[model samples]
Target: EADIYQTPRYLVIGTGKKITLECSQTMGHDKMYWYQQDPGMELHLIHYSYGVNSTEKGDLSSESTVSRIRTEHFPLTLESARPSHTSQYLCASTGETQYFGPGTRLLVL
Candidate 1:
């Protein structure tokens, strides 16, 4: 496999609820990334971390937050989800090469 996995491939929830998108990798990579994408649009890098205790915001605006406390796990959380937050969340980790998980599609109404 590609060494990356995301849980809850699809989600639909009402507005004003907390949600978390889980991302995990088995490659023991130090560089992890989370991207948001809409249908037929380019992926926007929202969050990234180089290593343990090293996190940085990417070149995009996002209401989500991520944690890289472990080398192979990066999870994103939204305090309160909204309709605007509906999008596809993709997680990736760089080994010798970059590998991306399938993704999680979330819909908030």
Candidate 2:
């Protein structure tokens, strides 16, 4: 199995609800990243961190927020999800090559 994990591989939710997308890596890599993507499209960088207590916003604009207080856990949260928020969220680490999770596919109505 890959080093990362994302639960609720698929989700259907109504508008304006808080949601947290889980990302955990067992590889023990210090760097982690969060990306959003549309089906069969390119991945958009949204959030990333070099290590614990370190965080930075990526090139893309996103309503989601993320934290890296723990070495192996980096989760993304949306205070209020909208239809525009609907997309796939991918998590990766800073290795020679990124190891990605299956992704969390969310659909907001």
Candidate 3:
């Protein structure tokens, strides 16, 4: 409901393959967040940004890195994907309220 969109709604890739998860919002929010979740599990915050040029790692440690080059776009990149990295990635933005994208489901074989 956040007017946010995530690309590659589903993906299956081999181990060691580098991949990027794309997230974008049209609401012009200054705060954005990324979370990782497994099936029937709680979401873990992996990254967040207060605004453009300002990013911070979340409570959860992640091998993936993120960038906030623009206000509407926040992409997470995995230099090398692994089976352990397999999980669903969620993108969210906040103003007075939080909005979340549909999420991207990734599976590393």
Which structure among the candidates has the greatest lDDT? 3
- Model 3: residues with Cα > 4 Å off, grouped in runs: none
lDDT of 3 by residue, 1-109 (tens): 5589999899999999999999999999999999999999999999999999999999999999999999999999999999999999999999999899999999999
Each candidate structure's TM-score, on Cα atoms with residue i matched to residue i, is 0.97, 0.95, 0.98
Global CA lDDT computed for model 1: 0.93
Model 3 — which ten-residue stretch has the worst lDDT?
1-10
Question: Model 1 Cα RMSD, Å?
Answer: 0.8
Model 3 TM-score (2 dp): 0.98
Residue 95 shift from truth in candidate 2, angstroms: 2.4
How displaced is residue 31 in candidate 3, in Å?
A: 0.4
Best by TM-score: 3
RMSD of 3: 0.7
- Better by TM-score, candidate 3 or 1: 3
Compared with the true structure, all predictions reach lDDT values of 0.93, 0.91, 0.96
Ranking by lDDT: 3, 1, 2
Q: What local lDDT does model 3 show for residue 84? A: 97
